[model samples]
Target: MLLRLLLLICAPLCEPTELFLKPSPSQTIEGNSMTLTCEIQPRLQTSKAQLQFCFFKDNGALKSGWNSSPELRILAMWTKDSGSYWCEAKTAKATTTIRSRRLWIQVQRVPVSDVSLETQPPGGHVTEGKKLVLVCSVAKGTGNITFLWYKGAMGLKLGTKTKHALTAEFEILTARENDTEQYYCAANNGFGLSLSGLVSITVRIPVSRPVLTLRTTGAQAVVGDMVELHCEAQRGSPPVLYQFYLKDVTLGSSWASSTGGASFNLSLTAERSGNYSCEASNGLEAQHSEAVPLIITVPTENRRDLLTSGVIEGLLGILGPTTFVLLFCYCLKRKIGRRSARESLRSTSSPLPQDSTYLNSPTPVPLQPVYGNVNTLSGDDIYSLVYSTQLEQESPAEPPRTLSKDKVSLPIYSKLKKITVIDMDYDDAV
Candidate 1:
């Protein structure tokens, strides 16, 4: 049984087949060393196979190792030293030497340059509510590098990226004032590390919408009174500039410092009416306050200085109707006097005019009639003139009667009752 076990173990070593070279480390950093050893694939643990080892780099640069030593060491590796390295093993019992399979070694370059961080907004300063992008890049390096971004002195890791590319980016959505701090980035390859200079981020906050208040003891603004416009913003980073506006016209401006607000003053006038507003700015775009509607009126002390509009309007109401009635009565009296004179002339000699149109015409009285007994006629003659018509073409009716006292009585028109305005209190007597 022992002889059988020996044959099983030694039988593989009796015939040699293939040899391969293996390196201690397949990948190494720059300026480091690695070792390659040549071995037989099928070997007995106790069998003696004498071999001469030779190491070749990229099929050139031969290195001879004695049978005593089958290993070769390459020191101070560089970029040029990266290639296939293999070994040849020649056994003392074999007639020809056999070459081993190739093995490859990689030499990596460490970064020896600085890193820089640039902001997207060009200047590191950024406006609030805007996106902030930090770009980290290396000036010179070769290898897979890891980039890390730190915020402030706390070295808080904002983000990290590992890639073969020389540049990486980190982003912050909706930047705030608290985000303003010293920022930096680092590039780390396996061999060495590089840190960039400090980059500062400044977050600028714009002024808020201003609230405007009018400072006055009374509800209204009087002419020549100094009225103050107080403008305030709930939140902002200042020195902030403030302006007051009346109907889009600028009154004046004021300034506030360090998270505060501002104000403006104006001398009130009648022309200063309609819409009023205020504006707030912090070297940024201007923000305007909501408009407040204002209507200014004139102030008068006594009734004589100029009667109050209410009292003047009441006087006109009473006088207007009275004047109208008096004019109506005067016109009626003139019409009656003319008719009386015309009738008196017809009864004495000249007959009344036959043309109905002539009696109703609006033309002025003839110049001759003004002197011809117009004043001498009595009032009774006017009444007969309206009803008089000699029955030249009368229907079957009562014949015309002679003028009598009762038939010619004067017709009296009821005069518009004289409108009398009394000064009485219409309000409650109390």
Candidate 2:
């Protein structure tokens, strides 16, 4: 019974517990060496044990096994070397022990050398005879590289170099309309060939020699007349914008050819009677035509009417003051003449005049008709003269004789009574 108890304790103590590998989670590149070691727990002297190292993939397939060694060595590892492995040992008591741990291997790969190409001033209708440059660059890779340029299907070998960057320049001298096509590039580093994106190029042809033609809607332009002046380039490409000018000032503008030429018109005015010109441009460049003088004449009859009206207005403005002065002077002269005539009438009709001593005095006088009659005065006329003389003496400067007698001879006074009735209608008319 004691022996059986000893055997049971010994067997339980001697059995293997767990197995593991050193560098437990290791990794390595392809075409490289890797080492896997098996280790047992409880400080077992594993050198005395018969060891077996076995490897398997996670998919339950056996890779390889060794029955005599605890260590596994992999030389020049490849993708197929990547698997889980374990170690087993057989002791002198014939008991077998297995490792619960697993081993893994990793492989590295080289980078690919692929490149792309691009061009500036990218697409169609580039200016003709202009220099164009293309750039080629590697999109992926880590080695010496060279670039090759190609036009359509033809390959143009550029220089080879260790640098991955390269540029190719092509000058199109005197480019024709037909020199346009698709272009591409390739990058190579002896390992492989990589192609870039395709680019299309078109060389633009400049417009032909422009010819400006001037045309008018009418035979002659008159002032204030609506006229159309057409400036056209007959041979230019279509859809060109044009601007019209008169004497350096812009009148208006119009658009025509999309590809090349245009026409602009203007309505004529008196101020537009100078050299007229037009300019055509198509976003790229502009050109101006020679000046064409357009004369706008005014008719002689209309000019004469304007001059006559000006003269009449000027005359009226100058004559207004002179006429006012003349009228005032004439009114004053009529008043003075009437006053003198009244004075003469009063003196001649005075009393004591015919055979009096006053007639023998030194003052010689001529006898004139008084009141239109040579008369010896009646008593009433004598009294009237004496009374007027008295009144004139009372007011010396403003005597009654100073009153105008001509006013009394006016048509207004003809209805009044007169001392002598003379048929003097003919004389008054004269």
Candidate 3:
């Protein structure tokens, strides 16, 4: 009984020594809470021991100093928080310090969002034979992410990448005409996939010197004949505008939307017979073609034959109508003459009218004098003679009134006198 009492007294003096870190729900996702505890073995019964706890990650202290609480709570966990973690326990006076074994915590991340696709130069436009790059990125995603590049259609995969980064890129060593198409990308983190909007890529090529060709309907180009001017560029973009030049003056322009060239019809004339050239452009620098000389030949014999044939056809068209009209007029005249002869014979045999209405004679009427305004001067002359009716009835008893200076200076002439003198100059006087 004395030995048992001694053992109990010794147990009261003993202190706890083991230390460990315990985490609830070790694996967690982002935006979730987790609790971590610093545990001690052999709970203190009678000893006056005060303990302090601290948390660490990858050997880095989580707090500035030791805390009185033995539990550490993480309000929101993230992928970056995943690492080796350990806890330390000590007394207020630091009489003893104990460290627990390191522990690893894995924090998952949310699904991908805000997926976008961009280009290196930022316009998605690249010149032929140059390098082009396509970049795909996400605003929020973690863990191993898989990026896919597509061209034209979704099923046609251009490339793929799997890495632990937020962004990825695909390169085209040499851009070509076939590379001008729509492109897009997709990002996945083994949880869900997100697709980006379609991006259009344009590959431009500088216009090449065009080749101008002339095609004639006949063996030789002749005056007043239609000739075709064909201009084509061996390598260039579609919707190319081709302009035809005569010597150095612009004739006309033609647009071509396909690989083949454009054509402009020209009517051969004496002035149009000269050096011809063409140019091609598609919103870039224009390219000119070599000048081609042309000479028009005139055929006199062919022209005379054409004129004779045309005159003969015109006569034939009018001959039928003229003959039909002449025949109808002659037949109608003959029928009217026969009817008139019969009517005259019947009238001679019939009795005459006894009424004297046909013997009446008409009376003759006197002519009246005419009064009019006469203009003697020619060639847009404003001066003319104005005859007033008031002067037409003048009393013979009254002498002829003389004209005043103002009356003569004016352009009005109301009285006309008959002169008996034989001087011809007086008749022409104004």
Candidate 4:
């Protein structure tokens, strides 16, 4: 009996006996209302129990007020009503209980057939022979959706599909310039139809290789000669402007006729002799011509004649006296050289006779009359002595020495003898 009493008391006090409501894991949105219903389960007798319900968010915040009603009403549901929600209940026995099951609310927007279009390799223009991809997609919708692609003003459909989103690709493996067009996309469901914004794509064709032909009025251009250069592109489009360049600098420009050719006239000076090239450009593209060198040769003789008759003549007039002075100096140098040569010969081979007036008389006179003994004699003394000897021989006062022919040679031989005599008296005095 005591054991049964202890069991009854212990059971009621053991981990508060609870009863609560369990909501379904998912709830859907339809029309303007959303209903959230919960199922109640009790661990004890709920017949006598009064239950109160409370709703809580997944973040542990209370979302609705406490009540006994199992269903919560959301009027005019929107995307903000979508979240995790749960219920709590308290019994009259003071036994409180919490439900473990979670609810996920989802608000479904009305389906629409409106679609938007996008393209890859995005640009307003593309090159010829290039591949293009166009994608069309509905922003919000349910059920099957259809898509269509059109090109140009005629609204010709290039492709079609039956899906919520569709993608189409167009390839012109070898596209020409004429392949330019406007494009758009369309989407349709059983409910409604929608069209995408229009787009324009232009396919560009590359410029052709330019043919450069040099045109000149004359075969040869002389320096300081005026000439014209004509560059033509026979296959190109026009209002084409031709730019004439020498060594890559724009010298001048000319406008071509509708035939796509142009000419520029330039005076051929010395500075214009180099690689000459031209470029032709429309608004689309520009092409350069192959370099053609223009060589201008001027005759040296003609230039020299012009120089001499012009500025050079005036220059020569001012410098003529200086030139003459230089020539006169050169002639004087030649005359001085000849005079020096003659002086050298006279000094070496025939010496000038000494002036006798500057000579001292011989010491103590000669002791004996030594013929050819005269050592001190001026030029005048020698001349006078020689004249006196010649006069004495011519005079009739003295007879000439007579001897045989063999003897006659003796006096001449004696006169020719060079005698070196020493005087003892002059030596002793020294």
Candidate with top lDDT is 3
Task: Kindly report which residue stretches of model 2 are placed more than 4 angstroms away from their true locations once superposed.
Answer: 1-115, 120-126, 142-146, 150-182, 190-193, 200-210, 223-227, 232-239, 297-430
Model 1 C-alpha lDDT per residue in residues 1-430, reported as the tens digit of each score:
9999978755655776688888877778766787888877765354444556788888584655445467887776766678888877665665677688777777878664778999989889899999999999997766667999999877888888997768988999899989999999999877566888889999988877889887864677766677778888887777888888888888889888865576677777766877889999888778999998766656766324346666778888998899899999999998897776566555664223231111223443331211112222333432212222222222246453333334432422222222111111111111
| Residue pairs clashing, model 1 | none
Higher-ranked by lDDT: 1 or 3: 3
lDDT, residue 292, candidate 4: 87
* TM-score between model 2 and native: 0.41
Question: Whose lDDT is higher: candidate 1's or candidate 2's?
Answer: 1
lDDT of 2: 0.55
Task: Say what the RMSD of model 1 is.
Answer: 17.8
Ten residues in sequence with the least summed lDDT for candidate 1: 421-430
Backbone atom clashes (below 3 Å) for every candidate: 0, 11, 0, 1
Write model 2 residue lDDT over 339-416, tens digit each, in one string.
Answer: 665555566632332211122233434333223332333332321211111111223353233333352232111222
Ranking by lDDT: 3, 1, 4, 2
Off by over 4 Å in 1: 1-84, 87-108, 217-220, 295-297, 301-430
**Top TM-score: which candidate number?**
3
The models' CA-based lDDT, in order, is: 0.70, 0.55, 0.74, 0.58
List TM-scores for all candidates, in order.
0.48, 0.41, 0.51, 0.41
Task: Provide the lDDT at 273 for model 4.
Answer: 87
What tens-digit string does per-residue lDDT give for candidate 3 at 280-305? 99886699999999988867886677
> How much is the lDDT of residue 54 in candidate 1?
80
**lDDT of predicted model 4:** 0.58
